[model samples]
Target: MQSIRSLAARRLRSSPSSCFTATPASALGPGSARFPMAIFAAQLRGIKASSKLQQESTADTIEYSKLSDEDLNEGLQRETSESGARKPFNVEYLRESMARRPHRATYDFLSPGHSHLLNIALWDALPLEARAGNIPDSPQSSASEETSISQFFMPSASAPANNSDHELPSGHHLVYFPLQRPISLLEPDGTDPAQSPGVPFVRRMWAGGALDFRRPQNMQLNGARAVCVERLDTPNMVMRGGWGREKIFVDVVRRYGANVADLDPSPSMTAPEKLLALENKVWDDADFEERRTLVFMRAKDDVPEEDAAEAAKKPKAEERIIKSPREPEYSFSFTPTPTLLFQFSALSYNAHAIHLDLNYCRNVEGHRDLLVHGPLTLVLMLSAIRSRNTNSQVSPGRFIRMFEYRNIAPLYANEELRVCVRRNVQGRAGDERSVSEPSARWDVWVENNRGGICARGTAVTHV
Candidate 1:
């Protein structure tokens, strides 16, 4: 099989050089030629992120007085209900099932075996610091001796940062998390670990890292100049042993790409406002909290065909079209013609089947079609808005809060789509210039090739 390194090099060679030609390291990052690469290099220099999962779980249960009664009740009730209704997520059962499943992790453009071979090698090379960033419940390294932390960088997949003597093909940058010490698969609530056991095919490869998006875009976005937009569709073979409670599987494919950020292209954004904007963009590009939370949103059941058809045909008024946002607005569009579907079985690590596999979706999960990954959607929005900036003055540390998003519609394959980002009028109310302006939230709308909106949402950025 052709190696991942060869594949990546081949891809770089095959694509037009003028658009995404590799730049010298000095020209990357924010202030220097090395700005773009440097940004990722900094990420590789892992920051001290608080690792409390940030999602609801038994771990979040604090002693009385601090958390509200409502918050406490929600957690307690949810736990009790889950423990009673379903068996806790079966990592073992999933592993065995995955062994029988067809899909495997894939790097874009590589032949299947070559992609797997290349990714597996990188999985072996992943740095411990990068691995530590993904441990749920704040697991510490054995070297730390206590609840400790270390710094590592999350490398950019765009450029071969490790353009070392040895390289993986497919050019997909990947990170793997191997436990410094064995963590029991047992849930803290005390469930039977033996109930539906499966094999331990990939207990060590739990991790997250950015894929070097290799595409370009030149368009007007939110009154700003646009940079290259990435295209990561057909998340077919990628796999992850999901960490924490929902230790199933995940398919992190991004088909729609983002536009890069430039200096206040939007004449409306002032100098200070633009800099302030960097704070949240950087932080979010760094954090993965919301994605972690949604791991718990799996409501699989067999909705009767009548119900499914009825829901699809429900007489809902057409999504009202709007001219502009009451605040900072963002919009993005993409083609999904080379239609793709990513399948992540319960076995391929910790991901659930909700992400891929149309049959499981139809028969087991009971949906109209396969559901699109939420993280993929969020990444698309961020990439879209980020592409619009020229200054690229982002600082992950300055982030403040999450805006909001209402999943306006469900996205499916085979149709071209557009994603839009815009500011929130309510957030800005009187606080227009407050780095905390109404611009924090992005009103996101996903449109199909035929110009129909499938989903809409709002996202808040702190930077």
Candidate 2:
């Protein structure tokens, strides 16, 4: 096999170069003079030999040191050798599982509810005083320690007394739930244990998403049930740098209400009676729920465009740089570290490689460094907006109704970032609040140290 160095040299030599012709001896100055035909031919032959030797010396080849394609993917390289190559993504397989089974999670009031957990999440997320501009750090009390509190009071590991449930704030549900199973994400088909040939090991990233809160979620301090219904929509292709960025969206509807059975554990209750109790609903109903779209992004080889017209539509990220706004009503800056990334991942039970595996990030996804979580940026932006309400209250008669965000560029760890939010002034007709415009809209974005916007979006709130 031709070594990489040799290949590079050959490629260079093959490239177009300046016109070259030996200068005539007559053009030479001083003692230089033309040679006889026979002598010139002999000299030309000798010169050609010398040139060949020099080329060989300059083109010295070195063996490729890094793992070969086969070595890096030894077992997987030949898995589908006889079957040719399989597709990198199985869209049909994912589509077939469109109707996902519902899942339920129950949380106790004192289980360091979303509020405390989110504050704990900030411990690693907040920037240092040296960089974050005196932004107060979260309480030193660790989430793990808070979680252990319930265990300590439990009479035994098997059974424990129930505590009153607390209400979770908007967007807080994202922090409380356990991480989704990573199986279908990596192996959608799961027909084989090992990946097939030509099937790239794609890394999943948290692209920004939208959340719609229907009503306030009050935790059943006495133990309420959260019924979560999820559906995996058909994946769409998002154009990235010469690649087809697959956007996989999962729609989740979480309904938090009373657990009728737990509300009254009557042993003598009949099946019909229990069913009736479960059917009974009041303020706590599915009407007051939240719908969330969790988007996962993966890169695939760019599909060839049909023609120039189609190709012209795909513009690079640089083309849209001017669209990001600069000035904002409020801005909160902070620097994120790898420690925060690790801690946030642990808190959210997220094991995405781009956030944790530097090798996978560089070798597979082609990132310069570990990526900061997109959800973390969104959380920080929301937190910054919430901080403006000095009352330290969440529901102030006005609440954010809908929020949509997207990741513009990847923000690496330890980078300084500023989260900015501006109230939309487009529809404002007067200084005084009016019923005609009961809701307000705001734009939110995160900018890197270089003032490049890494993420941007808009939010709608009903005052």
Candidate 3:
């Protein structure tokens, strides 16, 4: 095995044609160098470079730190007044502004702290380009319309990004897969197969670092920001992150009901001198970390010590451990179906292809099969509650909080994963004016046939 020093020297000594010196990121235009693809790439490389490989390649970057939710809120309080609405969502702008700082992986000292600031920058910049192309052949078409991106992603050509869209390396990829066939997911219900939702838009880069946002609004929004950064790349690798989920959830609820938006609008201001006030409210809010105890299924050989410890520690979950005589919360455990995964990806407007394309997920995100977003568990629970309780409804507006959910295991395809909730009656019981009182504070958890919890939590009800 070669040492990192030797590897660096070998790569550096290689033909100039083989190795190129990267620019100081600052050299690029505002839009040229956006987002921390470089840092993420660094993380991936650092992980692969390790010997044992016990830790995750990417997740190691978040400390989530010990910051109380209120403390986290305080970090966002308007540091000063008149923080004008000057280019708030441009990834490039955010990058350029942030470049001046030191960089760090975990939040600790952050060698410098500009990584996530530009996270949502591109979402605001990716507008649907008209491109002034030749009129379409179809009679239904007008002068010019958006370029439809069904399954292709054209890489950008901006000043050469670090993570160039090149062919997969020898061992990095499991196999080359064609973008054909639907990825495996739950089977659709013939009875109520509503339109599978989501903007399967690909955020491809152009030759000169340009991108076309010709996708639909719901397909994309001001809340998105992406960058194929080179300055942050290692030798022959790349990394990138999307900024639509948070925006999508917020946008969807606002579309359905603005009242719901008020619950927790992270970055917004009012007409009154409440701009700072509004920011402070979020900055000073509590629950810096919203901890939810979840249950997930694991193979008999795969049950984790963390899960075991939690189970043993709170064996019966008596009234002593935030106890409640909440009904023995039990919910449906549908077998994994293709229809479910597709519906979820659509609802999320994510197009990395990992979620739908099991092959892509295994190839890029480097997961065992398809990985489920922790939030999806919450979604399934919400869906079940809606189906079981005839009158209970989900109101996004005035809906105030979620601290955080730590996923302890993966819910593989085809496996039956349960979602259960047994809430504490005296907790923050919701809807002071609801109809039924079947224990608003319910204890919830989902387990597999092996008796392993797949997802679990306590949720309030709005009758």
As for TM-score, the candidate ahead, 1 or 3, is: 1
Candidate 3 Cα outliers beyond 4 Å, as residue runs:
1-327, 363-366, 386-404, 427-439
lDDT of 1 by residue, 1-463 (tens): 5433344334334332111112111111132211122222222223221223222211322233254435544544554344334334323223222122211111122112322332232222233321111322233466547534331222223322222211221121111111111126442211112221222211211122222222211111112222221211111112222222233322222121122343333534423333224422422242112111111122222234554465566443234433333433445454432122232111122233444556755675445565554434444444444433322342221222332233334555444567665644434422223443433444655565555655454443433
lDDT of 2 by residue, 1-463 (tens): 5443344334323321101111111121212211111222222222332455434523431121133534433433443232123334433223222221112222222233344445555744443211211111222345466533342221211112322123344454555544333366434322111111113323344445565444443333223443332222112211122223434443333344433344332443323233223323321243234433344443333333453346457774534554354588777676887877887777666666778878767876667778887767777766655544433334421255556666777888777888888887445422233236556677888888778888876666654
Order of the predicted models by TM-score, top scorer first? 2, 1, 3
lDDT, model 3:
0.28
lDDT (0 to 1) per candidate: 0.30, 0.44, 0.28
What is the TM-score of each predicted model, taking all chains together?
Answer: 0.33, 0.54, 0.31
Give the TM-score (vs. native) of candidate 2: 0.54
> How much is 41 displaced in model 3, in angstroms?
25
Clashing pairs in 2: 163-221, 164-221, 164-222, 165-219, 165-220, 165-221, 165-222, 166-219, 167-219
Residue 420: error of model 3 in Å?
1.9
Report lDDT (Cα) of residue 104, candidate 3: 11
lDDT of 3 by residue, 1-463 (tens): 4432344334323421112122222232222212222222233223243423323422331332343444433432321111122212222212222222211100011110111111111112112120111111212234386533321232222212221112111111001111112334311211100011111211111100111111111111111221111122112122222222111000000000001123232322222222223222322221121111211111222224654465556443111222223444445555655455555444433333444678755654345566454445544444343332333232221121221112334565556666554434644443323334432444555454455654454444433
> Order of all candidates by lDDT, from best down to worst?
2, 1, 3
- Candidate 3: residue 56 lDDT (0-100): 41
